[model samples]
Target: RKGITKVTVEALPAEACRVTFELKRPWRWTPGCHVHAYLPAYSLWSSHPFSIAWAESKPKAQPLEIEMEKIASKNGSLSHSADIDHRPNIVTADSTYSRKSMLGAPTVTTISEVAHRKDGVNIAIPRDSAVTSVSLIMRARTGMTRKLYEKASASKTGTLTTWGAIEGPYGGHDSMTSYGTVILFAGGVGITHCVGFVHHLMLQYQAGTSSTQKILLVWSVPNTEALEWVRVWMDQILRMDGRRDVLRIQLFITKPRHRGEVISNTGSVQMFPGRCNPETILKREMAERIGAMGVTVCGPGPFADGVRGAARSVVTEGVVDFIEEAFTY
Candidate 1:
């Protein structure tokens, strides 16, 4: 059994909660992996499968903020780096981080500084820095999920602590590292499945260990508040080395309370209103694909079906492979 360090429930109307566990021993898992969580306090015999959202090791000597600032200052602008030639031509939204003209030197700004200056959210430790803790984002439904959420909600601190056990770092059979271009589709809480892949691919791209040249994450959610589910993990990815050169995120808000609610945070990361058309998004990415492409989707039945259909439509076009995540219980 592991120690459940904390359970953080999101504000009301959003039933999702983040559960963090402290492992007795180090465990390694690839992106797109999951574990069957058994929280005896909530459900004695029942265990629910959840995607591993984030993992970390014990911090080293220096503070994470200090490390982030140092890396940011050293890396400077995203564009105009020495390894720019190795990256594909990705269309980025216009922002203060946009690159200057070829004749002029682009302004230098660290991602860490921009994150703090605009969002007032401090970028925490890197997601891959260590492996002592694992976190999962669970959307409250019936059964154990509901009980955990209810207990945490009733707590004075909006968090609950208990004992839990995790079995089998299962799934994650498909690896996108070999593909030259990868596109991940996530719907609602399914973002948990795709977040780990993005983190893994980014680290591989920086280390020159993988063949991936481009990664596009397309996520569809009900409202802007849904973004909170993966906000902390996303911040760590945003700070990773070569993140801007390799990773592009497109967030589609299916329901919006106001026009002002949907706003793009950076040039590479953008937010849009209305649902995304998988076929259109697939075709657009295929037009600029670097090499062999791999596509994966994790979401509701209808959403996963749409992505599968889109992938099937383009099977005759070029080298493409599709994978869908499903839990049978």
Candidate 2:
């Protein structure tokens, strides 16, 4: 499971990151399914894991993509080098270290080559809001590898030894195939799950086998640039849908450079130039919009809690159904 085959720069949010890989023979995955991503080695045998962010349905094309944020690292110095920003370090038989020592420090050891494989587990990304399928958002730690840590050039994510992991396509509580509407809320990496889930749902809607679920996406990010990664794809999808009146997209920037920059002022979405904790969401009219819609939340705990609390009040009235996918600890 330790091998490096190719590295490429792909699109995502506001950032484009270097995606390195070595797909094993017969590598397989679905469009929304993600695998455990491991960084280069640290010591002789250590690596970190992150989610395989792109759709893996097609086996003929590139298999991975990392949505890189374009911000330069402020921590690339001999003194700041002490930070575990980026370093290729994966766990292997030859690798040796402890949890404490590897916490902030991860070192990379170059190999002649790298190889990777699945332990035999594949997951299906949610394609519909059916009772049988669930939309889950779980998070795990992954080390930043050396490719991300560029002391000379600060465009890449700081290289580290580890990153994050994901759970499964496990089920969630929703009405059914004819839910009629799907609205998703995502902040930061939470957008990861939203992106996959929306792709799945929309595809079903277009096939005529499912209800024409109106899609409303409200994404809370720090800036518009963050949307750059998926901009191209979203544009393509939007053009294909030809149902603008039904699709309402709101991009909420919690840290906009100018004032009054919310994508829309009437919806549950609001733009701010500061933080977007659960408290900020609590202060909004999310409950009203959530009424009669299948509201799904994926973000940190606080944000999820905020969504849950607001929806709980309305759910008792049978206005909407709320499902939260905690993307972080």
In order, what lDDT does every prediction score?
A: 0.75, 0.44
When summed lDDT is taken over every stretch of 10 residues in candidate 1, the lowest stretch is 108-117
lDDT of 2 by residue, 1-329 (tens): 33443433332334434243423332333323433443343223443333344443223433221211112233333343344344333533221110122445432211111122221211232333212111222222223433343321253643222322223323333323345666677776577656655655555555666564566666777765555445433443443343343455556577664553333333322234555443344334333343245767877677677767766665555546677765633
What is the alpha-carbon lDDT for the whole of candidate 2?
0.44
TM agreement with the true structure for every prediction = 0.77, 0.55
Off by over 4 Å in 2: 1-34, 41-52, 56-178, 260-292
Q: What lDDT score goes with residue 146 in model 2?
A: 33
Model 1: per-residue Cα lDDT over 1-329, one tens digit each: 34444333343337878887677776666678788887888899788899888776643344355455566578884433435333333532223222223345433222221332223222222333436667888898889888888888887878767777787678877768999999999999999889888888877786788899999999999986677677767766776667778899888989877675565656788878899999999999999998999999999999999999999988888999999887334
True-structure lDDT of candidate 1: 0.75
Off by over 4 Å in 1: 1-13, 59-130
Count of residue pairs whose backbone atoms collide, per candidate: 4, 50
